[model samples]
Target: MNNINTRNLDLNLLVVFVTLWETQNVTRASERLALSQSAVSHALRRLRDRLSDELFVNGRGGLLPTPRAIELIGPVREALAQLDGALKGAAPFAPQYEQRKFRIAAGDIIEFLILPRLVAQIAHEAPNVIVEVLPYPQRNDISSLLENGEIDLIIGAPGPTSASLRQTPIISVPLLTLIWQKEGLTQERLPLNLYLERPHVMIEMHQRGENVIDDALRAQGLARRSGVLVQNFMAMPVIAEQTGYICNLPAQIAHVFAQTFNLSCHTPPLDFPAPELHAYWHNRFDTDQGLAWLLQKIRQSASGP
Candidate 1:
């Protein structure tokens, strides 16, 4: 093999060479590349000069690769494949074998609903991958955090999204009221008067001094009597267990807590909208193969098996 100086190489000429070799005709290769026939011919001549070999020769079959050209074809194809993969952000992302670490910001409920399944999936599929779950920021600074590479993804309710970020909804969790079953408040359907009269535990997703349930209640000229304000959904169940306060929680978490902690799940007396759970990432990672793979696993876990 000759030691050709890569600094003097025009990579576009190799594209032309590959196209011509595949098509076996200058006109066809030019059409494929959207270049003039003259440009294709010129690139071929340059390739021949650069390698000191007549890479192609006219024959009864329109064109044929020389022995030297045939020997070059495999390596040329491999190089182009690697270049394409690199340009498309498809390289260095073999999840089945690659060791990678991804950091995430998520609410406690999102973590509870998704992490166990996600962790199991990662262990089964990408054993070397590590997932770090950071507490969700209690403010509207996710865009800056994401841009600064503080976290790889954020799983939570949608808010004011940044223009350079993308959000993919992973799951929708309906609101439910959780209470201690032993209290006998759920023997019959709880009345709205009773619900509004009881003390409650509420989740503060952003620590913004406002809860979604409270906002909805305020819209109808009503409000819950909040006895406790917690930063995470996980704490609400434990607090409710010790007190008579009802906890308004996501249905998924409420049901899990009911089964695990001997609590009761009841439909909210007020019409409450389900909160959407979305996986958000910076737009720069939109084409990232590893993020794409991890997202696929999350979606599958959300959908169950």
Candidate 2:
């Protein structure tokens, strides 16, 4: 389209398009926007005419984006985010009573440590607020999600460096070796030989990839015997109890799991520094009061329990 034709387009149509793409249902998108279903449908029809494409089509369970939508979604979402941030100047956030929601992207490990405290505080203070936790996305989607304001915070490895992002360390604790007593291990601290010889039940977030411990082992030209591979830390206790495989986990959570299961926690025989977890957010939201409040809550969650 020419500049004149593009200038004739309504900005509200783009908002409707992004909402539909996110919700993937006309009814849900309309409800979210406080618009009647017919009004949302009409907006979509007008958008299709201006863009000259069937942006979405009926699909199983919900609407699916066509090729054009997938192509344009990124740019449209970014543009909307910039405008939304500019317009949200110095709005006061009332955690005590605001009916607001904050979505966070985090791994189960951090969720194990932080969610309990965060939820308790939310329930006590902000009865009407919602806290949604989503799994950490892959590399590229992390940047896209933060820029689009889809998530308020992300807790995991550092993402791509960008001027729009702000990040700070969350926590770091030594990794301890976890083992079932049936393994006949009696040293006050596990021996390096036993550590390397024992069959290891490992947590590899990326399938078949090395975790922090494995990476350190590789640096010394050593590796552990892999008996089983699981995805999350929550499952390791069960497998360790039934089998004699050794598992490694962060010290705090490892002790918690040790007391619950009949497993024992020992200082890891290897010498490597603990990896740091960090929280990331978009710089554009520096003045978003709700986000600022929630960030403080998260930091408090990490400081104690």
Candidate 3:
């Protein structure tokens, strides 16, 4: 990196390099930058001469970034975004008149717990805004998605490790029991023996790993029998409704399902600290007023009536 001198380097060429890396097609890069194909080629040439590296190479699908180009992308993107933000200045975010889209990566249970009120608030306030709620992805992962700006924000437990990332706790969740009313579950709370005796429906968000409750129970030298293992949160309550098996879940979500399935909600026998939900965003976007405003709305929705 120190080998290249910035004094002779044109920032426009870096822009072109980044665009070509993103679009992976010279023609599309030219279209996005509003430059002639030959001009874009000239910029690429300037980039190669300035950096003395073939930053990109043609592949079967499109242009593939070279190893050096891959190494340079994160810093380059951050520099460009910083420059853009500075030039735009700190304009106050006006939600009522703002027209923007936001993407949130969260799981089904969170969607059930948070989205309806959020959507309603946005509709009434930021009427021109659009919201896209994506199911928590398993393959590509949220860290890469948030870093690359594919996602605007995330609502889930901690995992991202990038230094440019920031997170804040958004929800305090207590564990509760969802049981069929006919199961003769205690109105106040289920006894520990009853909790262990009944077959339990366990939720495994990733379709792997032990049930989250298992860890807490294991520490106390106790464990419950999982009559079923399910992937999605919705299925857990439904199975409990039909099979008379008890399912333990966050209180917010359990009550909603109980209302829907004509089931009963009760306190779980064991005491566990509340699990938390967090909102994560890139540090680069900390200065984005529009995003800041949307984040406030999400926070209000999570903690609202």
Candidate 4:
């Protein structure tokens, strides 16, 4: 437990350390850092003295981080990243000229509804910015992904809840059950028993045991036999159409797919809850300018002004 408080740390030296660790060679690090090789070596020596460890050693014709260095890497990288983000926040957001990649973790339903519009906006506003949509593994890990900088933002319903996460409401849409128009499923209200009896398609984006939809159903003392269990919401409509299996999806997604596939959506017979789509990010990025700009863009796109 080194009491290495960053309050009085030299930020520039950390930058040098990162460069050396990345390049694994003092000469190459010096070239990349735009400093003399001796200066880079001196900085490494200073860092070693401060941390009381020979952080790196020569091996395989290059510098290799020692065991102690491996231990320090995570916290050091996180601190440097936070500092970098803070400094960038002080400047104006100029997306077009900035070359940066933003990775977002979102479900397929969100990608279907929000990504197209957001891409259009980015094309007009930030042509140089690259956007990558990553698959959301499970609801529980969303917070960890955002915290680790693996994903810039998460766009979906708030999973459980967390104090470390900051969620911004994008829109509230009534959940709807979708079925093929030709199935003769009338729009007239039906009883909960009828809805439960129908074959269902379930979207399970969490671990093996945790199913939010099933939990919701159990809360009301009802259970629907799932004919299909898929990881993505985008596949739900297709599966539903092929198998005549009903699915619970957000209204917007159902609307788009229904129009495309000539399906019909109806209000669920059960007292199902509406889905609240929100934009979530770790508190560490609450003040980041790039994240803020992107969040604003998403909010506006979701609102469709």
- Taking all chains together, each candidate's TM-score versus the true structure is 0.73, 0.67, 0.68, 0.64
- How does candidate 4 fare on TM-score? 0.64
- What's the true lDDT of residue 216 in model 1? 86
Error of 4 at 223 (Å): 1.7
**What CA root-mean-square deviation does each model show from the true structure?**
5.3, 17.3, 15.5, 14.2
Q: What is the C-alpha lDDT of each candidate?
A: 0.83, 0.83, 0.82, 0.79
Query: Residues 1-305, candidate 1, lDDT per residue (tens digit)?
Result: 67799889999999998998899999999999999999999999998998999999999888899999999999999999998987776456777888989898887776778888999999999999999999887557778788777888988777767689899999978888877788677443456887898899876545322356777888999988988888777888888888878887777667778777667888888778777788889897776788888899889887765
| Candidate 2 runs further than 4 Å off | 1-91, 207-210
Error of 3 at 269 (Å): 0.6
Clashes of 4: 0
TM-score of 1: 0.73
Kindly list the per-residue Cα lDDT of model 3 for residues 207-301, writing each as its tens digit: 22234577789999999998998877888888888888988888877777888887888887877767778888888888888888788888888
Q: Which one wins on TM-score?
A: 1
What ranges in model 1 sit over 4 Å off?
1-85, 88-93, 138-140, 186-188, 207-210, 259-262
What value does the lDDT take at residue 37 in candidate 3?
96
Looking at model 3, the pairs that clash are none
Candidate 1, residue 179: the lDDT equals: 76
| Ranked by lDDT, top first | 2, 1, 3, 4
- For every model in order, what is the number of clashing pairs? 0, 0, 0, 0
lDDT of 1 at 19: 94
Alpha carbon lDDT of residue 119, candidate 2?
Answer: 89
In candidate 4, what are the lDDT values of residues 159-210, reduced to their tens digit?
5668898988886666777877887766555457767777888887563224
